[model samples]
Target chain A: MTSASPLSRLPPGPLLVLGYGNPGRLDDGLGPAFCEALRLRLGGDAHRAGPHRMTIRDAFQLNVEDAAEVADHDCVVFVDATLPGPGTFSFEPVTPSTRRAEFTTHSATPAGIMGLARDLLGADTQGYALGIRGGEFGGFGERLSPVARCHLALALDHFTALLPRQEGRPTVCATPIRGEGVHHD
Target chain B: MNPVLQTDTERIVIEPVTRVEGHGKVTIHRDAEGRVAQARLHIVEFRGFERFIQGRPYWEMPVAVQRLCGICPVSHHLCAAKAVDLLVGGESLTPTAEKIRRLMHYGQFFQSHALHFFHLASPDLLFGFDADPVDRNVLGVAAAHPELARQGILMRKWGQEIIQATAGKKVHGTGAIPGGVNRSLTREERDTLRAPVSHMLTWAREALELARGYTLENLPDVGHFGDFESNYLALVRADGAMDIYDGELRAIDPRGEILLQEPDSQRYLDVIAEEVRPWSYMKFPYLKPLGPEEGWYRVGPLARVNACDFIDTPEAEEARQEFKGLAGGGPVHHTMAYHWARMIELLHCAEVIQRLLDDDDLLGAELRTEGPRRRREGVGILEAPRGTLFHHYRVGDDDLVTRCNLIVSTTSNNEGMNRSVTQVAKQRMEGVDRITEGMMNEVEVAIRAYDPCLSCATHALGQMPLIVELVDEGGDVLDRRARSGGS
Candidate 1:
């Protein structure tokens, strides 16, 4: 993976990276932990536009109210911890989905939120879902498992490489890598 | 699709009921003659949160317990903070502290109820319960009723802004501490919240009218759907007004006779006890005097409205009167009335918030206070959006929590949900050769009425989908149908 700054090559518009899961549950904290790492790498100027602006947020789960926030951004990447898979991580574009797969007040999928943003708020924001493989999810603890930490590092490296280059080629992965980390429709 | 024919008695199971908070399932049993024998609601996962909190420092509880449920974390946070206030001998908080906490709580109620009504419940109402699974969802609602759907999203956002301002963040906020709040609302925060009050009020009123109109228009169906007579319980102010933040315990029978009144929060154990049944992970709570069988009662919006004498807010009070008139001065046993009652409370929260935003006390500097002596044990009881939530704790001399017990709102409504499922099963599934999707949804709709947060009740986690299975008496799988999405 390239050590160059990923933000420099991204689309020139506001970007929202939301990482959500229960930090109290072991390995479930992978999302927030990844956000913390990304924030540090971006430094204090992350919120300001270098080439493009970036905002990072963490929550216990995605909710219906998040639609408004998503609408305000030009692009959004939803990061979450997935059950152990063959690959370290999987990244895919998220389009509006009318399907209500397990939709509830407590949680909403990236596709569902994107759908709400488009349908209710008339937003044209591009969306992507990034799922990092996790091993431990049974107990209540703040620390991430060792294997999950390794996967997180690898996933971060792969994500940084997947960003668009300065030539302004396509910004994100169009085709989903079929893996356990990818959520099936 | 039709269920396969079987000779012996059969059991139909609906696993991971959709649209509600967490994971749970429903099972219906049929006798040899295809008569509805019995139905049960089973909580599938268990986290043992009470046991999880033990050995932790008492001061860590308010924030620690928020991990119980992502949906109602603020409810758990405030309720735990209230309990810890007693442990620290700070039960009487400064006016500013109390108001801030109340504001935070009202924000929780507003947002939670809005989400349930607009997203979870409205899909079933807007499109009939039997509507195709593909079109029965919030997205579908948005496509059909854009304006109403927009109002729902904005209403939810407004309430969430209130929570963010008061609680310090939207998720797992730590503003509430042992003695009092961490800070008071700043002038800027106050203005930001105040600007949207009128708009929120208007939307709230419109939503209430929608629920009221639906209930009245479909009275015959709504009234009879999962309808049954039982006891009602909630936390009511001393003067018998509806008070969700803090109050004494009140339980009224189906006839509106007070069975238990003005019981201290500390005496909750004396008034109610939980009975463990072998079939499910959730426990059934009942009035102590009546025993398990006869004492089981319902809680949440329906019960809160029935148990309280009147709502303090004028708009909610008028709505409550009309809601009560549905029964001609009697308690409303109609399960579908929960949606209407929830709207009333949502409007009341908006009014109360509008009033509180004007109070100088919210901007006051006095944030916390503590008494001279400390207490070893304490109990906190408040009406969460779902129902009355109880949090109790015992602290050791070292300031570590020795024990903890949480009776979440959903646990209180467990028996009621089971009864509703049974009623729907009997009404829609009896003598049917095949259980259609519509019949399955009828059972789910009954459980959805209570808005049970199975995650909060069991302290577990999972994404739920609708799965129905048919099994013979010998536990052999006869047929199975599964849906990718839930209710």
Candidate 2:
């Protein structure tokens, strides 16, 4: 690839992703771990993770504004594990500014957060946050259990059925913000 | 009968303006020969929040009151969380958690600020009321500045996502659970935030540059925030960062007098007293030490700028310099300058959010800690895009909330905005002959400069019509006003 290629122009720019939290806490650090898997799938070239043609961050960082920032872009597939929610898995588009309470964390409802982002970015952006249900929620579980790990470890072949008959990044997740919960200080 | 021009000596009144967050009115009278003599702005909402939350669960208080607004939820989330954090006995949260909270707030800033610029105030900046209703809105902005409109929306998403993932949701933010949060992030997700965060930083700078190049307000433009000299208020970390979280409640006058810097945000009533009038539902708040006559203040961008010494991030600093250069000082007190301040904050939010990603602790495992068993009553405060927001609640022994109080951004600056409107009217329209719809729109935009979300401000349901009116000396109406929205 030529040095002038768009893909080669990263690393020097501002950081696009930084997954924080303790991986030992089970679902806590599933963010970075998910990206690591995605990174590998992309052959370290974020674009290879399916046809969406994204870096690891470009692949995920799912916010309405993220779409606008990359004008020529299409979709974002975020991957993360949630602790002790419903058994198995669930998928839904996030809205803006709505907040939901977790056992240990006080977060805005994914709906409200993304909805607000949509309001800000308007027609320029659109994306989704994918959450992985985790077995280890309380205290410290130290590692992704079999179920959660399997979810993160799934290959591209598995993702094909999730979206549709598409090659490049398939546009997804268009929903309004809906959620409500109190955040304790 | 006197000539039409001579009727300026008659007394007139406008009960309430329409399509705004809170209640307010305009009174105009002719002194002698029929020109407008005296005009005043009155607030009508009272202090329901302080009176209701005397005994409530401190932890649940913030969220309970957060129902106050569909817009600017993060401000209440931060303020309430910080106040309760102060009430509860606990060490500071992990830096990672703090950054997460700040990052979410920045997201709030991006969305709220952008909303103010686009959805609420952009029409006046770009098109007058004369602009076709069908194409005057986002369409017009898209036509005029598509790139800016695009950036504004996307940046908001990044901020909201950071908060949403951390708290499980974004608005009515439930992320800052007492003792610590109830959730932890996955490493991969943290990495994902990097790209959007970085992209936002670049775009935010572009936003700042664009904002610097254009003045968001004109004395006679539609959807414009006019200039007004008033007291400014906001909270700031001792380090002078862009404080949306915890800090003493400080008030500064136009001359920069530190009127009050109470360590407790709940003590807002002591330092601040709200005034209600027959004309409007929105309350006017002024320093208790200084009566309404002496209490003219402002909030939002200009207020935050005046109240804070400097911004926390680098791009914000550059934007801050440009802001100073615009109004000829370290920061601005003019309400219109809020447009500039809002963009600067958007840039800061993007930059600070990225810097937060660099922290390895974000990728660490230790995030939440169980709280010691207890029930407490408290209030939280944060500067929403509009102004200060207070969420107070009372929970019983069983951990169920029994009472709630919401002192939203509109309430915090009700008194200030009322005074601000009168000042703006006097300065921008008093001596003018042609007071067309576009001119009146400028007056309305001044109130919108605070980006008041009446739904959240009053915790009131429905898109009720908020009214503002101008009255003459003979108790006759001169101009009755309501916003000409999407319709």
Clash number for each model: 0, 126
Candidate RMSDs in Å, in order, are 5.6, 13.2
Tens digit per residue, CA lDDT, model 1, B213-268: 99999998988899999999999999999999999899999999999885579889
Name the candidate that leads on TM-score: 1
Per-candidate interface C-alpha RMSD?
2.5, 12.8
lDDT of 2 at B226: 44
| lDDT for each residue of candidate 2 in A133-178, tens digit (9 for 90 to 100) | 5666565444655555655544222332343323464422232111
Worst 10 residues of 2 chain B by lDDT: B459-468
lDDT string for model 2 (B56-78, tens) is: 55666556545445456566666
The lDDT values for all models are 0.84, 0.55
State residue B369's C-alpha deviation in candidate 2, in Å.
4.5
lDDT of 1: 0.84
Instruction: List DockQ for all candidates.
Output: 0.45, 0.13
